[model samples]
Target: MAINRLLVLFLLIINCNLYFSQEVVIKDDKVLLDGKQILKAEKISLAQYSFFSVKDDEEVLLYKYMDNETPSYVNDDFFILNFLTEKIKVESTDLGKVSNFMNSKKAMEKIIKWLLKERVINRNGELNPDRIVIFKEKYDENITARTLR
Candidate 1:
């Protein structure tokens, strides 16, 4: 009986971790990595993505990725945008044809704008103050504002 109880507890822990490990998507504005919204500005800034625990008074560099060339095929659509600590990488099933789309500035801008808008990255470059509260509701205390700070 004790062994069975231990196994059940272990399973519960694993399930809980898996449930909370996935990215938390914001309902209204949608652009969130983990639980914070991405920042949209003329120049992409890393500070906006950094956790609040980071020292704001410290100087940091932000890097932006721009498509320098056009994609080669119409089917080359980006399907996922993943963010790391300091960099964001976009992935597409038709990666070989991505260059074709990248070549058309208008096409590239449209795609980028859609991603920004969908992800809730304010084009005007402001952080959504309610993000933490909203995230907590969806995730049920899995993440907290104090924890972020």
Candidate 2:
């Protein structure tokens, strides 16, 4: 029994190391995954739907921002969504006023920070696929109703 437990623990550690071995590197207008250019960043204007697209070889990461109220110019609650899957919507109300992130560098930096904080992307710059599955199974649809418009 003890030997089985040790083997399990060892396997767990190896798995963790594998996951953490991946690295995400951000350069000017480029997102590098494990030293390869996987995405190119570009700024755009799409009203409330999106601010930019981080285009990878096979997928486009639409970076969206939703303001929940009339343009008060202050205290307007917002949500940042759609980096990977639409199932996850991050409330940015407590994070302060989110304006149009038009600068590619700044926008990508902020997006990466949020992704890291939310664990949507692992430290090695890989998407946490489990987040999508978990969110789809348990995410609240109504939480985004106010911002959908």
Candidate 3:
């Protein structure tokens, strides 16, 4: 019985670690998730909008969105920057020409610069303390809600 309990406890620990262990690294204008390239820099154009999609066979782990505040009547340009396992959605008309912003590397760099300017992350792509605090609060709220459920 003790051995079984130990094994279960070990498994639970490993599961928890896997759940929270997401390492986001930006290198050479490419986003690497756990050291694997996930962004393909390809565009999917539709009648209404065109945006880049994540690489095939990869899970989305991080996401961000931005807008240039262009009027609704005009065609808008946007970017999708995926860091690790999620999506980064950015749409801005003032971001310059559509063709240039459509490139995933440019979009990712633009968003990363914005993140740095906003102090959300340090120059090395690590989350700053303020961002960490926000994350902790969200985690606490999530845990509380789960317990209530």
lDDT against the true structure, per candidate, is: 0.35, 0.52, 0.42
- lDDT tens digits, residue span 1-149, model 2: 99999999999999998886545556765666567664565555533323223443433345555445666563564445554444454444443323435544455556555555556665444567677545334433435656445
lDDT of model 2 at position 17: 87
Pairs with backbone N, CA or C atoms under 3 Å apart (clashes), candidate 2 = none
Q: 1-149 in candidate 1: lDDT tens per residue?
A: 99999999999999998885534333332334455543322222321222111223221212122222334553422332333332333343433322334333333233334434343234432333344234223323221222323
lDDT tens digits, residue span 1-149, model 3: 99999999999999998886545445653455557653332223321222122435343324333332543534432433333422222223334422333454455545444554455555334545555444334322222223322
All candidates' TM-scores? 0.25, 0.48, 0.30
**What lDDT score is found at residue 107 in candidate 1?**
31
- Output the number of the lDDT-best candidate: 2
Best by TM-score: 2
Error of 2 at 105 (Å): 3.0
**Of the candidates numbered 1 and 2, which has the greater lDDT value?**
2
The residue-level lDDT of candidate 2 at 95 comes to 34
Measured on C-alpha atoms, candidate 1 has an lDDT of 0.35
Sort every candidate by lDDT, greatest first. 2, 3, 1
